[model samples]
Target: MNQLNVSEFIATSDFRRFHFLLLIIGFFCVIFDGYDTAVFGAILPSMMKEWHLTAVEAGALGSYSLFGMLFGAFTFGVLADRYGRKRMVAVTVILFSLFTALGGIAPGPKVFGFFRFMAGLGLGGILPNAIALLTDYSPKKTRTTITAIVFCGYCLGGMLSPFIGILAIGNYGWRIVLWVGALPLIFLPLAYRYMPESSFILLREGRREELLAVLARINPARKIDAEVRLYEEHDVSTRVPLAGLFGEGRALSTVMFTAAIFFHLILGYGLINWLPKLMLEAGFSMNSSLMFLIVLQCGAIVGTVVMGYAGDHYSLKRILVGMYLLGSVTMVLFALNRNATLAYVLIAVAGVPVVGAMNLVQVYISQFYPAFVRSTAMGFSSSVGRVGGMLGPLLAGWLVDMSFSIHSMFFAFAIPGVLSAISISAVQHRYSTDRSRKGQAEVGMRLAGEVEK
Candidate 1:
């Protein structure tokens, strides 16, 4: 009886072993997402030469994937809320894995583009679910830190893709690179066997037994408190209405949040997708261009970890605004300075703040919404960003095709960075006002109930 009690206590604790395991799983999934997204950019130059494609054509192929991601993100957001996070994650992973492998076997650019777009759909669905799942398991105090650390997987994958592309393309071909990219499929079985559904979701669904089961698996050494029971009561309204995010006082804030994601992603994805080509056009060799891209991503990884800490300790909004300003200034400097060494240094500096800002935005979005609508909010915001991401590469490709100087293209990208700074600043201001209003309203309600009693 004592041993059973110990086992139950261990399983029900808030800081359970299963929670960390889930984070690891999420980290791996996101790493694959980063690798798949970055690999195309790394191999684009070679693919163009082999297929006799123009810059515009390649950009279209890139946009095709983003378009697919938009659909996937939106669809999975709704499905995850209506169905379950685990189910949606499983479906999306399988979808992306199969399509990513198929991309290697494409007979032409058209076929390849279709496969990439399909893969994008899976990519889109996986991330929001991962965020929701991780958030569910994470302790409140360490939530932001854990989320940011997990996201570093994205940066690591992006940084490693160029090296992988360089070696694989040289030894075999771009097709082989795509084939190897599908290796993430190996994780699906693990997810199926080991990944627990969100405890919150279980409580929401009124499956108390299942919730207890998961809690036991996660935290095998704690007493279940009355607070845990309270969670079930509050989670009774788990079926979130899709329009609820825009209803009540949430409409304007939701729109602004969506716009903020749009502009940030435009700057982030535009810079990432075009960095290698931009460096090459600036007279760097292919190998050097790839190296510079790697440096940029390495900076991003460091920035993400640092900013994650800052977000928890300081003002997230202030950090986000400052990072944008830093990115804009660095963009202008990179455009002006043609020296390869100096350019690499500037890009690295710029990348630190840019990726840091992006990571914080994801963390902020996850925290802003209640658990009931968290996945929906993440999905919608990410989908809107995907729209911007879809357009960014295409727009840059158009400029490149029009014979615009690489310096001019960098300046164009910098405009969005500046705009993002302004947009996010406005969002921060509005958020403060909204918070104040909510606080006052709550106080008023409490006073009214006291009077009635």
Candidate 2:
């Protein structure tokens, strides 16, 4: 009898408590990641006032964290693939949480930037591994949806940050908000206790007993007879996973998606990092600016769920293309609006297509690669996007320094979405062609097998 593949088992198994527990735990991990990342934007106004910094300096500060994230995504992603995913998750959570708190206590802008950069490293490290763990466990039928649910933590954290800033900044100051980010450290023990090692990794390392033990816990009702063999479908003996992304006819898809992710992140980080300050400049009060941020996140929550559902049922590539096109329109409208209520509405709408689509990029990328290279692919792609993430806020600041009008700045941001839409369209064509070829090859194999029989 052929050995049972772990992925096959995952696809065939009924949804169980173990599956739901994994999603909940993954949600908690991403929540703090979102919170710490967004809090900087929320508290930037206060930082500017306290330090008397210019827009360029503030933008550069935002880039500092993203630069760390770029490094972390590539470095930690490789490490997780080599060593394991479970311990990396726990360590990153602790590292980011501690440094985020230290950021609150830093006496100067440079020191604060250093702490933020360190926290970025942790924040960057969590995502690809978290998604990899979730992918290893989820059924293929629901992989995209499960990822979206896990990512909702990001929107939730982003939503909560502005509110926290509003309440904490008013009462205790911006530092208090940073100090609150340290709360994730309290959950570190839970991460260690609950998170399981990847069965795929276990099997690859010849740890059969350990792999069987995890699989059994995953479905306690099922008994594993001695006759049962366990395995995966592909050979991953090529020690370097990153090379596989360039092989297996994946190079073009990888490059196209990387470019798409890069541009999408530019729009995402740019808007989130600078929105409050831009609103303040537009004459909104501190409380109101934070409220705009809240509204934006609320829209993001809605958009994320909607996109997740759509991706599951419809063509993900087409849906993403439509979203980017819509985002272009929304950004322009957001720039032109002046009425307070209407501006709120426009910003909220902007969040749906812009922030919403940005969330979907990871889900789309995850689906593009095979299991062995999934984490590495996610890490490298996200690392590329982090380059955009770093450039975005810095560009916003530089544009501000150059005294560019807000309208022109937003228009510049919108241009990337158009390019992203075109690139994804090309990707869709390539993917369709690949699938057709796969179908033909499978048909040929089936015929040959029948003849032999």
Candidate 2 lDDT, tens digit per residue, 1-453? 534657667756766777888898899988889898898899999999999999999999998889989988877877777777887888789878999999999999999999989999998889888888887787767777888888888888988889989888987889998888888788778767877777667766777777777787677887876666776544434388888678756788778777887888788888889888887877889989888878988888888888898888888889889988988898887677667788888888888777778778778776776666777888898888789889889998998889887778888888778877877777743443214345645665321100000
Model 1 C-alpha RMSD to native: 5.3
Q: Give the least accurate 10-residue stretch of model 2, judged by summed lDDT.
A: 444-453
- The regions of model 2 sitting more than 4 angstroms off are 428-453
TM-score of each: 0.89, 0.93
* Least well predicted 10-residue stretch by lDDT in candidate 1: 444-453
Note the Cα lDDT for every prediction shown. 0.74, 0.80
**Predicted structure 2: clash tally:** 0
Shift in Å, residue 261, candidate 1: 1.8
